[model samples]
Target: MSTLLSLNAQSRDADHMLEQALQQWGGERDLWIFGYGSLIWRPDFDFSERCSAHVHGWHRALKMWSTINRGTPQCPGLVFGMLSGGSCQGMVFRIPRDYGEAVMRKLWLREMPNAVYDPRWLPCKTLQGPVQALAFTLSRQSPHHTGELEPDEYRRIFSQARGIYGTTLDYAQATFDELQRLGIADKALQRLLSYADCDRSVESVAI
Candidate 1:
């Protein structure tokens, strides 16, 4: 019980971090958020504008374990995380200054529950121009960073792991479908989806 309480306390510290970051903003202008994964399809927050944006020095990869929203501790699911390397093409959202605090609070609760992600302000290039946007990136040293895994491991997680939001397979499919609609092609994600579909077919045959 003490351990659980301590964990919860640590998670709440993310809220404090959010407050500190906001203080530095000075409420002078709009806030921009860069989304490379689920946020692309389900922002769940009000934004004044959004546009296709690119960020250098980092790329999106399914490198994090989702032990809450997409799966449990026993059967962890996979999620996207920004890692240092190539570039990533994603979406950047502009939140009105008046709404920045509220929207950021909601985002913090959604993404920083375990404080596993390191939120940073990154410069994103949009069709309009360059904008400094907040992005959640994962450190390679983090325990939740999956680095690399076997195809079978991914198949098992997609087939069997589920959580409050839904199955990991569904999450991956939604992200892939959304990216396709946006005219973005991700070959690695395509292969992952193929593995998931193959797993489902095998299960259907067994049933």
Candidate 2:
């Protein structure tokens, strides 16, 4: 996989921020990181192995709304949230302490570039036991946020928008495919495909 870099000034300064975080960790060899979304299938870093894990107090939801990719500015598409008081089943990868700085920098560049996320140390429940891991949560209070949308409005936005990568349908398909590959599924996301009002043949988002 390719390292994530900002294409413009508006992007979040991910590389710098991640380096700072790694420096704080001071190169702990036992460092492990968990990924649930795009990173689950597309991690660019070198890792020895990964296994199923779960994090409590957060659940992935399409909480972040964006018209930039899936809708117009007037109507944005939804993205994930590690909201409070829920649990998510995902995978965690262990990074060698020596490569911490580089791997952390790349991860921050990819996911935290927009400064829309707050990386918090959370406990990841692995087969061995609970391990401390840094998990990025979308800032619900950010001024740039579009707030939560009604399900109907969300459907409308998904039915429209085009992103930097491609159309909203493309976003949906990519997410669906990746999630299934991980053997994980969300009922909310599945429900979305059935409720969204778009031409499936042309503009449909996969379930």
Candidate 3:
């Protein structure tokens, strides 16, 4: 279909842009990626090793508006983003050097279709050691950025928002559960989980 081809082309273009961003910001060694959102729970990628990691000057917030995959433009869903602030705890994945470019392309297609996320290589402190990992963060200037929303606004959206990917609540719930399994407690996500109802979070397995 013409639409499919257009999407593929768009993905390629995004990958090209990401390559440029990394060229200026990435380190010169092993490829590591920092994931704090759904990628934390469902990293459909191949990596040699993964470990708990933390990055300073950034924290996760459900402040990005999803026009697709999770909601429509008229009634957008909220998604987690790495925002500038305090430190954040997340998962770091180490990819084999041979597969770095391939994985970067895949990641670009997945996370960089728009300017909502600014891809950058950030220093992540992993238990194994310190690693500079590529991360997708919120662009404060982007139209899709919501800064912060009240709990009721989050609950309203989580209850009704769904897209090709699934419900917004499912995404939040899965991330919360995954963090628990990793023994990494994110109090912020937990608060949203409470608003989203952690009691029935198991039903959010769809994400």
lDDT of 1: 0.85
Question: By TM-score, who's the top model here?
Answer: 1
User: Cα deviation in Å at residue 169, candidate 3?
Assistant: 0.3
Worst 10-residue lDDT window, candidate 3: 1-10
TM-score per model over all chains:
0.90, 0.77, 0.84
Whole-model Cα lDDT per candidate? Answer: 0.85, 0.66, 0.78
lDDT of 2 by residue, 51-118 (tens): 87888778776667554545556655665656666788778888878777678877776666567776
lDDT of 1 by residue, 65-92 (tens): 9888889998898889998888889999
Index of the highest-lDDT prediction:
1
Model 3 alpha-carbon miss at residue 85, Å: 0.7
Pitting candidate 2 against candidate 3, the one with the higher TM-score is 3
True-structure lDDT of candidate 2: 0.66
